[model samples]
Target chain A: MLDLLRLLSFGPDGWGDEIAQGALLTIELALATLPVGIAIGLMIALAKDSSSAILRGLGNLYTTIFRGLPELLTLFIVYYGGQMLLTELAEHFVEGAHVEVNQFVAGVVALGLVLGAFSSEVLLAAIRAVPKGQKEAAAALGLSGWRTFRLVTFPQLWRVALPGLSNNWMVLLKDTSLVSVIAISDLMRQTAIAVGVTKQPFFFYLVACLIYLVFSGASSVVFGKLEDRAARGFKRVGGH
Target chain B: MELLHAIGDGFLSVVGHLGLNTELMERYGPRFLDGVWVTLKLVGISVFLGALLALPLAVARVEGGKFLSRLAFGYSYFFRGTPLLAQTFLVYYGAGQFREQLTDIGLWWFFRDAFNCAVFTFTLNTAAYQSEILRGGIQSLPAGQVEAAFSLGLSRFLAYRKVVLPQAIAIGLRPLGNELILMIKSSAIASVITVYDLMGVTRLAFSRSYDMEVYLWAAVLYLLMVEVVRRVWDVLERRLNRHLLISR
Candidate 1:
């Protein structure tokens, strides 16, 4: 009993501090990747919806390649392959570019790339869900391309897209644990370390599970609030 | 030059290991084949065990004693909320601490290995999800039909089997199949615990070859597994729903 308390303490000797830091790293990792994912996803979505055949082909390839690959395999490709490619480019481009992919950058890029593939689906669906008449009306009003997208399309897209996007966020948050395998020392990695170092697997792991519950629960609550807000002023005209 | 050289050497080594650029093919066909066999066994057994355990557990949660319901709820929340990796560790390395008690109960031998532990965690994890799915399916059945079943002198068991189970299984088939595919992907997580399933074996092959060619071979194996299951499920779902398709 006392051992459990000691393990969770805040003192210098306690491992509680490390666990907290791990949680923070996981959060930071997700935050960093989330924006990258959203930007890449929107670009891919637009590319997929682009009138040009070349643009549509690029988007299809982007989603197909990443989506078809396993997340773990994708992680390995980014971590190992990214390093190999970056180092090679550095040697040629800048004598000694010293550009190495660290854990955070690797984790962000790996997770971000995969998330971009999935979120492209979400964004594309959102873009399509807008009543076609809205775009037609915008064009009829002489609003140009960017103006049509900016004024009429994008805002409606987010409101419609937020639910599915947030659902993807919850998944992305959970999957961040995969980054730990690549040596990112996030929550799961830290728990693995503490378990190995302490030799108290159940204690540390149960703590880890509790932490997940708190975080996942909090995320769902936030998602629920966002869904509610985004759903404002939109009532279903048909079946519930 | 090394980049070009690595690609050259990588391709040759990859192909030389097999005949006619059939790399995984001539590498002596059975290694991954056996790994896939074990993977399917792992998934099939765990899904079976999880479903069996979840049915009673779900019953306990929904209509059993109050304390039991809460206990089941706690178990569901904890297992479902956490990452699967943590659960795997708790079973593998964590079991070592309780060696004596497990041995005392003649269970240490079972807990001694990584495969057993991975299966155990997978079983428990899916059982929780299964229970929730079953519970939802049960609650969604029309109360009027149930009442009619009772009035016709059918016991609860008979009613569920004859009436509820059929409709539930119909509504549940697609979602359940999706879960099965997710489980197949999830079985890869067992690699972390050192079980050497398909992913672990692929990781080993990759480390030596350092060419992702071997890993690509592994992905094809996975895709085939997923596709086979998907096709079989399509047939089964169709057979079951022919009544709906035929229409009155």
Candidate 2:
């Protein structure tokens, strides 16, 4: 036990600091991707809900393509394909300018696109679950469309969307491990490096798994509380 | 073989019309086909084996005694809570840490192969997800269905085999399809451990030519596979639930 502690300790002889940094980077990547994914998902949801057939078709196409493709494949496309495209643009516009897509940015965009595709489904369901009469009542009160959505629809959307979105967040948290493939020093990659040096693959990988479990377990608790808070002031209709 | 050749020619002609690089396709096309076969074998074997393991685990979760239920719960929870990639690493590389003990047990050969490790890890991982799906399907049935089976002079095992499982499976078909699709996508991670699935071939092809089009082709192939599965699953679901449909 003491040997294990020393191996995981934060000093020249140990890998604790590197693993800690990797854990922080993993959290940072997930946090950075959250708003981008949610915003894109919201737009896609609205697009699917729109009256225009073109907009609806485009939304369906986006979700179908992104959700169908593997997340690793998406990452490769963004990392390599995005770099290729940017380099071409840069060379064309500015004489001999070089461009390399940042790994962190590529990870965020790739994972965000995937999360958007999935969350749109959840968000679209929640948007539809809001009673249509609420909007009509708001309109009858002379409220503008935006005001009606803000005052009446948005509040209830959270209550309905929270559980599905929480599930997505857990998935996103796990998917962040894939970014380690693109040479980002996320927790998984850091642990891999530690395993390489220490020759203790089981120890390091098991530790990595435990860290991830802690994050996910904490997330479940936090989301549970959020669901409760969202449910406050709403009357229970049927079951206990 | 002649029919396959004809299909290949037709595909090449389509690629030509699309103005894609035909030379790249000509060189890497066979490799990609091989990759597809590998991917299919990986997902197919693992999902089938996983489902087998899952049925019992699901039964344990929903119908077994307290000790069995808790054991199943812990197994499912551990696999579900962590990233599959991490689980893969733990199994693949962690095997090295136990080389001596495994050698003594004469099981080192199994862990020594990357493909075997991938299959084993994927089997365990998908079993957890599948068990949860099965549990949900089982629990979702109205309680009276089971009671009716018992009241019909059917034994406990007979009731489950003849009545409960069929209904649970029918209810769970869509989710099982979704799970299969997810497994197809997740199988790509096996490439990181050197399994040469579709993604592995794409990576190798990319390193050689550095052409972005290879990834595009891969994306198209994956999309086609997912679309095919989705359509087939839709038809199957309808067929299975035909009795549930209201008559026009």
Q: Residue B101's C-alpha lDDT in candidate 2?
A: 94
Q: How well is each residue in B22-44 modelled by candidate 2, as lDDT tens digits?
A: 88998999999999989999999
Off by over 4 Å in 2: B1-10, B246-248
TM-score of each: 0.86, 0.96
Q: Residue B205 of model 1: what lDDT?
A: 67
lDDT of 1 at B192: 78
Candidate 1 per-residue lDDT, tens place, A1-240, comes to 997879878767778988998999988898999999988998999999999999999999888666555577678778877887788888897886766689789888888998998899999999899999999999999999999999788778878899888867876887788888988889888888887777888889888878877888998899889777776657767833
TM-score of chain A of each: 0.89, 0.96
Output the TM-score of candidate 1. Answer: 0.86
Comparing to the true complex, what docking class would candidate 2 get? high
Instruction: Estimate, for each residue in A1-240, the C-alpha lDDT of model 2 and write its tens digit.
Output: 688778899988899999999999999999999999999999999999999999999999999999999999999999999998999999988998879899999999999999999999999999999999999899999999899888789889989999999999999999999999999999999999999888888889989999999999999999999999988868788834
**Total clashing pairs for each candidate:** 0, 0
